[model samples]
Target: EAGVTQFPSHSVIEKGQTVTLRCDPISGHDNLYWYRRVMGKEIKFLLHFVKESKQDESGMPNNRFLAERTGGTYSTLKVQPAELEDSGVYFCASSIRTSGRAGSYEQYFGPGTRLTVT
Candidate 1:
């Protein structure tokens, strides 16, 4: 059963360390979204990628964080100088389409990659 897969089920890093998280979406899915929950905060959207292009990146928290979907395939998220506040579960989701759903589509999420910063 192929859905979405995230690497490094859990990671612990010291402050200022760089960490990279990866995501593999379902085959043929054209839309992908990244979201996360940090420090007991509500799940926040990070960005959306349609194929190899970033369709919406308004949710990116800061410049220290970078996201990319190369070759319109798997994606990678890198946080440079990871801060203590960067510890949280990062989720990846994908679908044929997200917005303007005719009620027949739903976003499928991965188990998530938990990052611990200290």
Candidate 2:
């Protein structure tokens, strides 16, 4: 019954440090997604998870970013050797699968975690 939740609402680190972000989705929801908005950029999808498997990851930027959903309960995103350009807000969302109906299923979002790389 809970909405999506993110940990460490804000993070600040040097350009080469590593940072990990976490997200917990609503119970009984099988669809989990990650998004981010960098400075001067639109919110872009990073990846999606259906249960414990990755459904889509085409949007992931590069090899420095990694995401995982263990047991499909919660998800984690890690950025290694972070760059200044990575400073942005990371958002997580979840949705319940609905029957074939346009706009029937709505995705609930979490309070984004803001990351700043100096």
Q: Write the per-residue lDDT of candidate 1 for residues 1-118, one digit (tens) a residue.
A: 6999999889999999999999999988888889999878898999999999999999988999999999998999999989988899999998885457652147789999999998
Lowest lDDT 10-residue stretch of candidate 2 = 97-106
User: What's the CA error at residue 41 for candidate 2, in Å?
Assistant: 2.6
Task: Output the number of the TM-score-best candidate.
Answer: 2
Instruction: Please report how far candidate 2 places residue 114 from its true position, in Å.
Output: 0.2
Model 1 TM-score, all chains together: 0.91
| Candidate 2 runs further than 4 Å off | 101-105
Name every residue pair that clashes in candidate 2: none
Give the Cα lDDT of each candidate: 0.90, 0.92
Tell me model 2's lDDT, rounded to 2 decimals: 0.92
